[model samples]
Target: MESKTTFIIKLVTFYCLCTLNLFNAIDIYHNDSLDDFLQDHAKKSIPKDPKAGKLYDVSLPSNFTGMEVSVVQLQSSSVWAQGANLSYFRVPPRIYPNPNVTWLDLVFSNLGNWSSYYYNMPNYTFVTPILGISAYGVRHAKGQNGQFTSTTTKLDLPLIRHPIMVRFPSVWLPRGKCVKFYSNGRTTITNMSLSHTCEVWGQGYFAIVARVPSTHHVWKLWVIGFGVGCVGFLLCGFVLFKIIRFVEKRKIQKMETESEKSEVLDTKYVGHSKMPCAFGIRTQPVLETDYFP
Candidate 1:
């Protein structure tokens, strides 16, 4: 009974460890708190009567120190004709909303320290924070620019011609690959147009990631396979050599036995015994030339 209980306990522990590893391998990331803050309080930083086509910086509190958020309001005609370039991002012209709303608000965010929690790239490390841009519909008075009204649902702004150009300001950043992450764990790798720029079709999270340099990699699959192959080959070669030696030894023993049977005798101890001898000459000595008496 004790042995059975111990076995059950060990099995359960093994199963639990496997489950944990499975979860870690999946690497799902979603933050409700960050989403709630962006949807609610992030836009409040904009001035009540802000200038249209101008960028407004969203000031976050001390707890969110490294992060940055900004917003810009644009008219439909202006967005359609001349898309806005709000510092870090260059929104190209010929952009239209999906549902066709009157005014649009573009909110850009840079999750500095919180990037790792919200995003992950397996076997890679992030060189920069995750940058994101989202568009929303705003209810404002007709014919008035950036006037009084409430914010509406999120809008989908699709580009007609050139893709959205996102640039990281620091030019001296280390070289890395660009990866754009979209909703529901979908990811797309993009090419950098400039040294610190990545073009995108629409809004999503973007970051630069680089593969982690290895200091020491032990117990890897390839390493194990190579080691096993070398050991197996050596073992096989050793076995073949041993088999050949054994066969040669048997053949030599058989030859010696046959020689002894055909009247070859052991060496006599004349002077320390080196040469073989016949038992008693097998037959009388024959005359070599018949002239011998």
Candidate 2:
């Protein structure tokens, strides 16, 4: 039994060692490859449909002399009657107008899902109508009143080389949101903020995301908080289990002591003849044989 237990422990240890080694072997090269892939995608830009023209208020920043906007069709399909739409702008060059604010209007006809499979539909990408421009690039604000921040720090810019598919069940854009081309021929919407500007900063694809709610911001903090909570819960459970084990051990020890005490006390039977009485009965036979005498 002892040998069996040792072998099981060794097996488990070996398995864990193997698992750790495999996990450690996971290289960051995969992420690097993905980054390279995204860069390459930016390099080989996809062209948007010529029939579709974008109309936006262009605010030429004071510094930038050469500005060009390249519309890349990310993905599109028409299972339904609605004209298929997939578009985003990619700006590769590092020429941005300001670190404070710039605003531009983006107009398009068909705008729908991007970066998804055929079953999962996409919502409008831009949350703010007024997009903020900066030295870092273009980003949308998320709040009731759009917040402004310096964009000197860089960020991961998404680059889609070809149109990626998305799934949408509904035909019309949701209420309280702006989408679709206007019949009068203008998709007019308010910009998110003045400090935040939108311009064709570089060579890649670009589209304006209008006012996004604060709740829709990045979820990194929430994810980290949940992870910490999970770790704490596991530690609490481990401590509780140890306390239960200790209590069971104490109960077992008490029961063992009582069993030992019962074995030591060899109590006599209640209704049986004693050894002295047995001997006396054998010696004293009855002398009632008068006829025989």
Candidate 3:
């Protein structure tokens, strides 16, 4: 019993260790900062954005005048539309200018009617001096280098797309920014000031979209999964322990009962010579002699 209790205690301890490690592993995914904090490495800490002071609604609010829109061009061919891949556009990394300022990369192609649509569309007729700023940074491959390592930063503004001048926000552009504008389908770096209002030339249009943070919901899911996994593991361990103890108790009882039966038989046969007297060797011998004669 002591041994069994010891085993159970050990099992519990090991389980606790494993549980701790499992949770620690999960925490690493969510809070690398915690590790740095523990080791007194403040440099690696995740910096909070002041501009995004609090969680805000993704959709532009009623009073919002600023808007950004991304238009999808329908492919002339099929269900698989291949146009501008805007997934890369994001709030630039910390090292980049205005990490809060998310930019989209606009790609032009000749497979569709881009320039022709821009020329004919009345929506493209809007003309006011607006700055068009472009910045370029090196794209990195996974596991190849530090998460962020960009060498070049050039600012291209006052970019002329067509008849009108499209300017970039001078306040936003810095030394390490890049922009390339092209008259044809080619790419180039041109400058445009915010003072010059212009429209983009393409079959598509853009509108400012609202931004909202989704961390809370994601964290909730993680917590739920973690709790479920921990409880499941503990329940399974407990069930297994119960099954083992039950089997062992039954085995011990069976052995004890068998020993008791053996002792009783030995006691009855040991001194009870009178019990064999009726069928003893002498009586049997006498009956056989008579029959043979």
Off-target runs (Cα >4 Å) in candidate 3 are: 1-213, 265-293
Q: Model 1: per-residue lDDT, tens digit, 1-293?
A: 57988999999999999898667434433533354466555568777787898888887655567888888888878988888888678889888887788778888888888788787888888877789888888765544675566646777877777998888755456456789987677887765667778878888788877777554554476688999999999999999999999999999999999977877466766687678765666579876796745
The global Cα lDDT (0 to 1) of model 3 is 0.33
User: Looking at candidate 2, what is the lDDT of residue 26?
Assistant: 43
TM-score of 2: 0.21
- Give per-model TM-scores: 0.57, 0.21, 0.21
Quote the lDDT for 118 in model 1. Answer: 82
TM-score of 1: 0.57
Model 2 lDDT, full chain set: 0.35
User: Which residue runs does candidate 1 get wrong by more than 4 Å?
Assistant: 1-36, 140-151, 171-175, 214-293
Task: Tell me which of candidates 2 and 3 scores higher on lDDT.
Answer: 2
Q: RMSD per prediction, one decimal?
A: 17.4, 24.5, 28.5
Total backbone collisions for each predicted model: 0, 34, 38
Candidate number achieving the greatest lDDT relative to the actual structure: 1
Candidate 3 lDDT, 227-282, residue by residue in tens: 99999999999999999999999999999999877664322254745332223254
| lDDT, residue 237, model 2 | 100
